[model samples]
Target: MYQSKYPQNFPENFLWGGATAANQIEGAWNLDGKGLTTAEVVAKAENRKKMSMDAVNEAVLATAIADQTAINYPKRRGIDFYHHYAEDIKLFAEMGFKVFRFSIAWARIFPNGDDQHPNEAGLKFYDQVLDELEKYQIEPLITLSHYEMPLALTKKYNGWADRRTIAAFTNYTKTVFKRYGKRVKYWLTFNEINTGTWGFHATGALDQDSTKNEQLQLRYQALHHQLIASALATKQLHQLCPMSKMGCMLARMQTYPATPNPVDVQAAQVADQKNLFFTDVQARGEYPNFMNRYFAEHGIKITMHPTDQQILAANPVDFVSFSYYMTTVTQANQDGTAVGNMATGGRNPYLQESAWGWQIDPIGLRITLNEMWDRYQKPLFVVENGLGALDKLVNGKIHDIYRINYLRQHIQQMKEAISDGVHLMGYTMWGPIDLISFSTSEMSKRYGFIYVDQDDQGNGSLRRIRKDSFYWYQKVIDSNGENLI
Candidate 1:
């Protein structure tokens, strides 16, 4: 029962921010004392509909191939954030950013993903990056693990599907919490922990297998490990970094049923179960009733170590954070009757989709805020929300009206959510500057207020230019929400 008709300004402490993942931006791939990862291996076949299992299997078999040409897509060579972060931070400061969210490359720290000590160079790289952000007085919101996990772990230990990953992750978390605890305040235990269950095929968080049932099991197990690691990290951070704000990151794509029909309703429920499962565990410290029932019915049981349940119950996130890009519609079957808006699930004929096939739903942001806050009764942070469109630069200036409109509508809806009494902490759009896409692995699918002059074929000057939305966003941030609508 939430209603708000007019736009409302955010509090003075509201965080006007943007987000990027480590593997997406910090390109110095395998250079400056870094480690090889699955991201590097998988970067080659990005955006293609078909990839050879033999090729993926070969990369998996290769042990830290020193040569860059041997590595897959070379995402480690992304925007070269290692060299350009100073410039990037300056741009973010110009945009009046109060916070900037990014991830810590796990392989950067533990190159082989099994080391007891962190690499000094790896720690120094982030130290310098964080220092740059602090120089601008912008708070850093760091994610411990995004889509990029160490290939060493996957190769030797079979990744998160194995029980040992939880332990390794806990060890890594402790190492990070102890080292960076003083400088960093906000920490996310894991990035979209639940997505692995349904996103393994797309994101490859879980090792691929031949059977769908096996994939589901591996995904479920991987999610279990991530959740446990999250809970453990929360507990450790709270104890070690007493002043830190620890939360879980959920890549939330809000969905609305096409109709009130029972099947569509059921589809929405399925979507919720799929997407919210990790959030439920992180926020509530236990699985939801429906989730438990569904898994039980499916004969999918997550095996846990002796102390995992107690550890998770004892530690829960202090707040909830999520990244929302688009809204979707759900249908029971492939019938045309169920049609509204959809992204990943069954499609709907009635809603608009992005260039990359993601459905655009502005009001769905409001729905997502209400749903998470109402369900968890915790403070919410819109850590990532924005549009991914093909922005073109003309006459030495980028004219991205589509992006401007997308952000404007979403911002308006967010204001409505805040006015409706959702305890929203802040709003940070995904990729305030251009970076690589997690799903497609191409620069063509850009999501930024600022345009980076780069292309899929690696044929651009790597120059940075402000889009039309850049000025628009500057006003939005400066006004603190007054000028958005």
Candidate 2:
């Protein structure tokens, strides 16, 4: 059995759970009147390459959007979650999960960006899922959008650059709130909204052929519009579901200075500011002055309506939720070799890395919780945090002790954060069951307590098998996070 050192500090109401995104896990991409989605092409696995950001921005995105086909999308056939949600939810219940964080695919509900009515079949699918969770007494923390906007919106409106998308998204939110708001009391407006900065391909929000300057301008403009949309959603959520909590999700990545030099230290702060930029607006209800200077410095002008500013200032999210994967190091000079560093990277020497090169930073989780709680003074939810690695199926069993170690250290830090006076609502590691990778789009890069029988080439029986970590996690949750080995 596992035991926490600070058992009294782990709040009784603290949520012990896991998370999944609709686009990453739900396989019925075109089934039941569901239209095509941005994720089908842009976040498709075959489209990814381990290369520099310049190559990705200039080539990979253009090629993916220009030539992507539905068949190449592994997410289209994800572990067959659409057909096996009951079986999967049963596994989650067995683990004593209190909550499950997932997103409602905008394409599923709206079909296209602008639809007169929601498809009943689409809504029915979620109704069944929510009923299953309710049966288990597990709460649902729903994210309104998680990288699968309708392809029609991306093609016609350039995602969110045109103001018309704001109306379309608002319409979608209103429909879902009316349908499932009572069942799901917690909501996040977007999944890892900060990812839109560099991973615009995933969001389908950028035009491929635009010049560098036009790219940044369009990118921030889209972000500005999303900031507006999230605020509006918060207002709508409060009015329709007075008992629910609404939050904005961010990808929280911490970067330390590569060297002790003052310039490198200052550069690290700048990089951190870039990551916090999204929350600064949503939580504060207005863009910070630093963002204004950033926009001017980059020659990016965000055209906002008079009411847009008021909408933001008047409606701040009720809470803040974020995902912490790993922390990289920042340096004064940009390393052209780094793939996805926010500003730039000089690899961290203190930490060990996953097979995918993401550093293992358990302490960073505690730092993130404390900083976010101090910054927002609202409840914080650690929505997603886990390690993805190669798993070996040995005689019908998986020994993923690396994943167990990764989660155990992080949970210990989480208890420390609770003792530090952070008003944390819950903790949900990234997909509790195996699903396609959001970054590499490969099922081989697995991060799940329950392993799904699948591979990179999309070959497997779609079977679920409990790993050693699954039982370990069950014990931790059964003890209300009091147990951690």
Question: Could you report the Cα RMSD, in angstroms, for every candidate shown?
Answer: 3.4, 3.7
Task: Give model 2's clash tally.
Answer: 0
Query: What tens-digit string does per-residue lDDT give for candidate 1 at 1-485?
Result: 54555326677788898989887888876676677766666544544332221234444445325455623453655777788899889999998999999999888898877787888899888889889999999999999888777877776676776778777778888888888899999988777765666543223453444466666666787778878888888989999999999988887867677689989888878877778878888888886777777677766878887887787788989999998877667777744332222235556466687765666778888998988988899999998888878777789888888888888888888888887778888888999888876654677768887788778766678888888888888899999978964
Score candidate 2 by TM-score against the native. 0.94
Off by over 4 Å in 2: 1-8, 43-70, 336-344
Candidate 2: give the clashing pairs. none
lDDT of 2: 0.83
Q: Can you write out model 2's per-residue Cα lDDT over 1-485, one digit (the tens) per residue?
A: 34465344788888999999987788888799987776766444343334121234335545655653545567777777889999999999999999999888888888887899998888999999999999999999999888788978876877777788989999999999999988889999988888776645444575556787888888788888889999999999999999998999998978788789999899888888889988989999888777777788889999999899899999999999999988778878766445233324666778887777677889989988888888889889999999888899999999999999999999999988988878889999988999988776788878999999888777879899999999999999988887888
TM-score of each: 0.91, 0.94
How far does residue 246 in candidate 1 sit from its true spot (Å)? 0.7
- Tell me which residue pairs clash in candidate 1: 27-78, 29-76, 43-73, 44-73, 329-341, 329-342
Superposition error at 271 for model 1 (Å): 2.3
